[model samples]
Target: MTYSPATQDQLLAIRVNAGIADLAASERFSAAEPDMVEAIVEGIGAFAAGEWAPLNRVGDLEGAKLENGVVRLPGGFAEAYADYVAQGWNAIAGPAEFGGQGLPFTLACNVLENLGTANMAFSLLPMLSVGAIEALEHHGSEAQKAAYLPKLVSGEWSGTMNLTEPQAGSDLGALRTAATPIESGEHAGKYRIAGQKIFITFGEHDLAENIIHLVLARLPDAPEGSRGISLFLVPKYHVNDDGSLGPKNDVRCVSLEHKLGINASPTCVMSYGDNGECIGELVGAENRGLMAMFTMMNNARINVGNQGVQIGERATQAALAYARERVQSARAGSPDKTPVAIIEHPDVRRMLLRMKALTEGARALLYYTAGQVDRGTLGDEAADRRGDVLVPLIKAWGTDVGVEVASLGVQVHGGMGFIEETGAAQHYRDVRIAPIYEGTNGIQAADLVMRKLGLENGAVFAALMADIARDATSDEPTLAALANDCAAVGEWMRDTASLDDRLAGSVPFCTMSAVAVAGWQLLRQLRAVESGEAPGLAAAKRASVRFFLDRLVAEAAGLKASAMAGAEPLYALTSEQLAG
Candidate 1:
């Protein structure tokens, strides 16, 4: 089923919730006029529904295939991708200096949301490209940027991040990939990279002329663990001095991964320098690859959060439509006793409202995070730190919402949701990968509890809570109170808890924090709806915010107990006993 766009909701999120007015008033984002923003949102919706949505089911069924070491996508993917490149979608938010429109990053976030909702697997290509673009724009040498940024920004060449090895997943220090400097020759300032990187998304695709890989590897004399790592610019095909395509590099896709979802996007086993000729240029300083890769990974993390919004929106659309059409038992105590549409049923209504509310809340949170990201990019240090704190919340909680909403969507469809043909299952399967990848939701929560809560001696976390409180209307104090409670948990984690305690309660704290933040965002949208600022979406937006507050937010307040629960109870059970 093609995605029915959530343009009105997205526009409301951008204008009301995300506070685009402040962004547009700034000299940096002067081009973000209301008309342009609306046009961009509408355009993305139309494009996704028309060009991208049709490929969603096909990609799931056909999947990307490995043929003679080359990855081939389902039919129409290449053409659709070419259309994506040609239309300048990739360049819309890129730097103006490198053939880009230089729009606010939030617009790009919205574009991805629509595209991904239409076709999540197909969307992975550009999604990965955007991350690579962000990484190169920040750390690549001027020469590297000059040679790579233009094409990458233009989407003529795709990009991949290579951080995972068979032996090293989250533990970067365990990585054995080695990069040895080639001291002399035509490629003198470069290094010979030799390693095997697995689970590389879009690692091998023919849609783009070249694939630029930002690899994290250790130099021969580098220190052990994450610190010794450095970022490298490796291309599938070498680029000439004049920017022409040259010979193929030693990097090759050994095989494509068989996966549970996102089959349209190639998850490849990449082998570099098996022939001992893989050459790469360093993107940043030695022993600082972690910092550089984090730049890319951070970008991906926020977008991965957006993936949650995408799948949730898609699932909601499918379930809502099914509920409206499927005939079911008569409403209780009806005089005529005739069958009614399932949408008339109370339980189904609750499920549908919950689905839409969570989807909208997740969308609002993603946009809020994106706005903070733009503010951070424009030099608001506090907003930047706030964005950092929001990332883990959105990534973990947002994906959790996606899974929950998708499951509910399945329930709305009854038994039909389980069968793949109905299309509800695709959303469930597609979104399942989001929480697993981009550092599993557990890792994101640990980052939230252990690393982020302590930023600026707790001031960043405090400021975030304060923002939520400020947004809370007197009529709706639940969100603010919840934020305060979540803030208390944050303080406890930073000041009182041991490392084990922090890690153990991390996910719960993250959940409570996300509920507060998302509730505040929905409140802002609710105010806009009530005030008639977004007249067209008034009723729907109002209901969504209300259901979120009355149901989701009210129920989440109980998480504080779990959030502050110490680690002792977790370790009380032996590993084997727990496993059994």
Candidate 2:
């Protein structure tokens, strides 16, 4: 099946929910005019379809190969990347001062969303680089920016995050990486970084001239645990002051992971300073590494959520195509016992509707969150807090929808989907990683309950839910009920529940919050259709939003009791008992 980027859906999200108009009106975003944004959306969709979609099967069938310590992608991967860079796609939302157009990040997200849907693994090479650009923009030294940003923004160089170790995993506090100061010499005031980092995406690829690593290591006199961690920039090739490449640094790609999906993107086990000569420069103040890295992680989290939308759209399209073409058993209500397309069957239609509703709902939630971030970028504190509160929802709930929709996509194809030739299985395998990485959904849930809920003394979340409540009209009964349920649960978690109880209920509550917000966002689209603003897709958009509120939103309300469930049952079973 050919992957098709949902350009119209993305446009609806951008224009209706993401507030592209506000962005266009801003002096800071003078480049994001209406026509330019439309051209970008349409342009990226075509580019992804023509340039990247063809490589989807090739990449999956011929995964990245490790050749004597170097990672090599299948044919066409490198050339497609070259086209991407040559066309200035990577610079769309980059810093204009550094060879970029400096457009709103919302547009960049649209670019990545299309690229990701067409070929997710290839998209990672640029996605990580963009994240790196953001990190340096916020926290890099002036010298660091001058030496790196221009090349990175131009896609001449790529970047990756060096975090997880075999032993450390997600526990940043248990990190054992070491960084020592260069006391004197030409490299004085720099650092010698030594660590083995695993699961580094595009870590050792030959797609760029060099790979810049943002490393987290500890200084000798640092405090214990995560607090002592410092951020460092370790490049694959030493970058000279003149923006030229120097000798190879001491970084090595020990091995590439053999994964179930995203095979085209090498997941490398990286060995930094293996020769004791790998050097790095400080990013931001010492011991403030996590704070600095948060800049990148936050950017990645939302994009990862967008990845969910990517997978969902691709899977939905695949399933819909198969359902429309495949003839099945005779229709239930027809007079003649003639066979019809599976899509004509009532049960099949329900499944397809479920997939559409869930995918579109997640898209609405994503655009809503992106709109808030754009508002926050324009100096709206209230908007920023609201966006922060919704991040976990988009990342966690959005990915969950991806998995669910992809699974349904497979089911829609019946036995063919289970077969490798149909390509449905690949989407399922690829999306399964979204919820696992970029801070696991469980981690997101915990963040929502333990930290985010308490932002501004709980007033921020309260205000957000209040807005949802106000938006949920009588016609939106599911949204209305869910708004009340989510609001009530948020208050109980803060005011009455124990910490463990709150933790136990965090996931379900997070899901409820997402469903409520998504339902309201969908309502915004329906309102637009009613106003004759987008008469083109009026009927289709209305149907999708109505199905979402009636079915999915209603189904999610059952989670309220689960969200309020205490943690006692979780701890009741011993580890051995649970294993048994």
Candidate 3:
């Protein structure tokens, strides 16, 4: 549903008064561009409310079917996709020369949030296409762009990134896919890709003309591991120089997976070059596929984080609506009285509040990160640096919180929530995938530890802490303490003599960072209340921040202890001890 202008304005004002709006003004997030934000909000909101919502239940129930090697989407999906392409939704953020709107990624993030909330299964196809388009645009030759960009941008066809092989999984070094140079006339300088890629989304869908598959393979003579990898654009149908469809390529979908969620989207196991002639063109320099594909994956990671926030928001809305209407037990003292709505109960209120806090906090964090990316687009180096630091934090932390928040939504509905009819159960099921995909949360923690902690020699993180410390300055003693705690931890990281030892504390450091950032935003939100917006708004912000610090920040201590424990103890658990 389209949220009222009043509501949007209110949220914006609250964010603004709290200094959150300053995030965009700080040139950290470019979505602050009024036109871009409005266009994204409007287009995504309309598409979400109209096409996607109506099909969500159908997609879940009917799902997708694979027969005779082709997967058929649920009824109404094709029509929906056609409408999506007709509206140029797929082109909103692509390069302008390719017939796209050429909007910044911040707006795209907003649109993706809506898509995920409305129906993630349907949205993934376009999302994946966007990723592939980005890879091609950045590294493809002029001829390649002219041939493929128009169709991709117009959504006449779609795209896929094939990286996860059955044996490879997360270890690109173990990838066994091969790319041998062709020895023929028309396909001279081309390669023949031969490998099986697993878990390829939209591998055999019929919504588009010809799927552009970005395959990662190693040339026969190339050195092993990630260094020898190369990216190839292998379309389902070969394209003539005139951009007309030619012979069918040999990429085939072997089968589809039965997944826990997003079932409407096919997860196919694709076999390339079974016929020994899947003609492929290299995207960038050979032996640099991993680097080329990484740009797309990083973008996807942030988008996945946004999906988590969207699902959480949807769950919260559903739970709040249900609680306000469903009657339950009356107050204990009110003897012989009729039962009241669960919303009237203190415990229920607490659960709802907890859900709201988690969802809102996650949303703020995600949106702030989106805004940062937008700022980066505007050529602000500091904003770009900050965005880099926040990306992993937002992705890992936001997705983790999405699962928790969705579960809490289920909890609010009690036994009814356990049933499929409640819909809250679906949100829980859907969001569980977020933390697992786009690299697991633990992986993110390790990245934060080994990689991000060392960024700019810790200056970027220190600046973030300084911002939190500034916001935490207040008359409230608890807030003041929180500010001090944030500042202390930041200083500790900055002053530590052992960089590796400090880096060892990345997990704890990230936890503290979450606390610091959330607290910073909440205080900003609290100021919105002070500015005479809604009294409840500011009060809720204060209470939530207080609850977060009081209930959650203590984990920082435990994390810090673990961080200080060093690598040896953490890795010391043997197989024999583990068996016991």
Candidate 4:
């Protein structure tokens, strides 16, 4: 089955409901028109389905090769990337001053979903660059911005985030990378960095002229732990005073990781200053690298969530197509006794609905989070807070759902899914990394319960719950019951006394919160349907909402119960007993 992008009607509803239409009218996106936005989305979707989708399986089969010191992508990847750059898709949500289209970030989310659905591994090359562009735009020096933004924004060069080391995965405090102050020469006051960073995505690729690495290292006299770390702009090739590239910097891709999925995107073990000449300029202030890196990390977290949505959407489409065409057992009530499509089976229908509901729900939450990002940039402080609060939930829940839906997609395919030829297993493998990387889902849950809960002394979370409660109400009894369940769970979380109790239940709480938000968004979409917009798609939307409320929302009570269970039972088991 050919991959299909979201329908124009679906995109339009998201635009309207998320307030992106008004956002497009702002001076930042003043050049944008409704027709133009529609055209851009359609064009990109077409390019993705036609050019990129065909390469997904090929990418999986070919993977990426480390030829000598350089990384080479699978067939068609470089060409597709060039086409993507030439079409100006890279600049969709980039800074306008740097030659970007400066459209709303929400629109960028739509573009990412389409691209990611077509081919996830291919999509990752540009995805990491988006985070790099964000970091440079927010924290890079004026000179650094002038030197890098245009090319990175134009997709002539790609980017990477180098935070992981062999010894320091999630613990930034344990990083041993060193950055010593350099003296004399054109690069004085800059630091010469020497370190090894592992799991660096798109660290070295032939598709771009140069790779810009946002690296984290520590100064010689810096204090211990994460507090002393600093962010640096380290380019693969040195930039001259006149904006032209100079000789290659002292960085090399020592090796590439053999992964279960996303094989076309090279995960490299990068060595910096091995011969002692890798120069890097400090970004932001000294001992404040974590703060600066957060800019990129936050951007990446959202995009990661979109990855989940994309994979889920692709899996669902593939499963539905197969179910429709693959005839199976005879229907229970068939007088003719002829076999029917598997979709006719009640259990099969239930599985498809589960896939549909989860995919749609994830898209709603992700798009809503993207809209908040745009609002935070163009609107007030509250919008910024809302964006901050939703990032972890979106990243964790969206990805978890992505994995779940993709697994269901495989289940729908049955024997064929396990065989790999049907392509269902690839979706499952590709998405498994999402919940593990960009801050594991466990870490995200911890962030939600521990850090985000205290935002504005809890007013922010309270406001979010209030919004969910308000939108969750409906004349339909099922909807009303779901809303009450969500509200009751929210109250329990708010009133929970033990921090350990909250920690133990953090994952479930995050899941419960995401389902409620998704339920609320779908409810709003249903209201739009009642107003006679996109009547053709309304039935599917109604069914998805119904399935979400009946099946997924029903889990909220159990999640709440688990959340209230505290950490005592969790610790009751001895370490040896648990291991056994």
Candidate 4's C-alpha lDDT? 0.85
> lDDT values of the candidates?
0.90, 0.90, 0.75, 0.85
Query: Model 3, 519: alpha-carbon shift in Å?
Result: 3.4
Q: Over the stretch 24-50, how does candidate 2's per-residue lDDT look in tens digits?
A: 888888888889999999999999999
Which is the leading candidate under lDDT? 2
Give TM-scores for every candidate, taking all chains together and pairing residue i with residue i: 0.99, 0.99, 0.89, 0.97
- Checking candidate 2 for backbone clashes, the offending pairs are none
Q: What is the lDDT of candidate 3?
A: 0.75
Candidate 3 TM-score, C-alpha based: 0.89
lDDT of 3 by residue, 1-580 (tens): 2221123522442244223344446433434465555555766677776888778777877788888877899888999899889987888778888998776565566667777778878888888888888889988999999999999988898999899888877788888888999877889999989999998889888889899999999998888788989999999999987889998898899998888878788989999989898889999998999999987887787887877777777787888888998998886677757899898888888778777676666666666676666666667688777777777777787887788888988999999999988788878877788887767766776676556655788677667766765656554444445545645555565565255555566666666566556555655655666787556556666676566655555554455555554456544788788788
Model 1, span 1-580: residue lDDT tens: 7778999899989987677888998988889999989998999899989999998888989898888777888888889888888888888799999998888999999899999999988888988899999999999999999999999999999999999899998888899889999989998989999999999999998799999999988899888778799999999999999999999999989988788888798899999999999999998889998898899999999999999899999999999999999998899888979999999999999999999999999999999999999999899998999999999999999999999998898889989999989988888888998899989999999998778888999999998898787768477788888988888888888888999989988998899899899998888888778887878887888788899998888888988888778889988889999999
| Ten-residue stretch with the least lDDT total in model 3 | 1-10
**Judged by TM-score relative to the true structure, which candidate is superior, 1 or 4?**
1
> Every model's Cα RMSD, please?
1.0, 1.0, 3.6, 1.6
RMSD of 4: 1.6
Off by over 4 Å in 3: 1-36, 332-337, 475-508, 525-558, 567-573
